[model samples]
Target: MIYFVNILPQSNGDHVIHTENCAHLPNMRQRTILGYFKTSMEAIEVAKKNYAKCNGCRDCSEAIYNNYN
Candidate 1:
């Protein structure tokens, strides 16, 4: 899947990682392309390279979000 990371941080200070087609995905100007990956884990790991706190999208990557929580 093609993933993206929100440039804007959430109130909890997490930059959410999302699948390309996620309903909750941030607008283009507010997100950065995170490359293609088979799993959300790969996308989250990539986001973590720059952001200190990253979480998978609740709507698209529920499994990853659950693991992080």
Candidate 2:
């Protein structure tokens, strides 16, 4: 299953709302956010914005993997 893990923060909280089945992948279960956006373009934008502020390599990899895979 493909998961759209939102790495961007929302106005309501610091969490990234994710899409369904985002956690289905064994490696992605621990991911913070996975949300289904209206379009892939939007998802990519959010991912890029979030990746830029990542503090760890794992986070950067995870976000990239989630967006591409």
Candidate 3:
């Protein structure tokens, strides 16, 4: 699946990663494409290289969000 990371930081300073189909996925102007990934973890790992405090969107990447959020 395709994934993306929000360009804006969360209130707690995390940059949220979301699946393309996520309910809360940000608009193109507000996010950075993370590329096609087999799993949310893969996208999250890529997001982490650029954003130290990256977490997954709870609605679409629940397993990832649960681990970090």
**Highest-scoring model, TM-score:** 1
Residue 43 Cα positional deviation in candidate 3, in Å, after optimal superposition: 0.7
List the candidate 1 regions with Cα displacement exceeding 4 Å: none
Better of 2 and 3 by TM-score: 3
TM-score of 2: 0.33
Error (Å) of candidate 3 at residue 42 is 0.8
Q: For candidate 2, give the lDDT of residue 57.
A: 24
Model 3 TM-score is 0.91
Which stretches in model 3 have alpha-carbon errors above 4 Å? none
Task: Write one digit per residue (lDDT tens) for candidate 2, span 1-69.
Answer: 223444444353333334444333234544644345654445555655655422212332344333442
Show the colliding residue pairs in model 1: none
- Residue pairs of candidate 2 with colliding backbone atoms: 5-33, 5-34, 18-34, 18-35, 19-34, 19-35
Worst 10 residues of 1 by lDDT: 60-69
lDDT of 1: 0.90
| Per-residue lDDT of candidate 1, residues 1-69 (tens digit) | 999999999999999999989999999899999999999998888898999888888899887885763
- CA lDDT of each prediction against the hidden true structure: 0.90, 0.40, 0.88
Ranking by TM-score: 1, 3, 2
List clash counts for every candidate, in order: 0, 6, 0
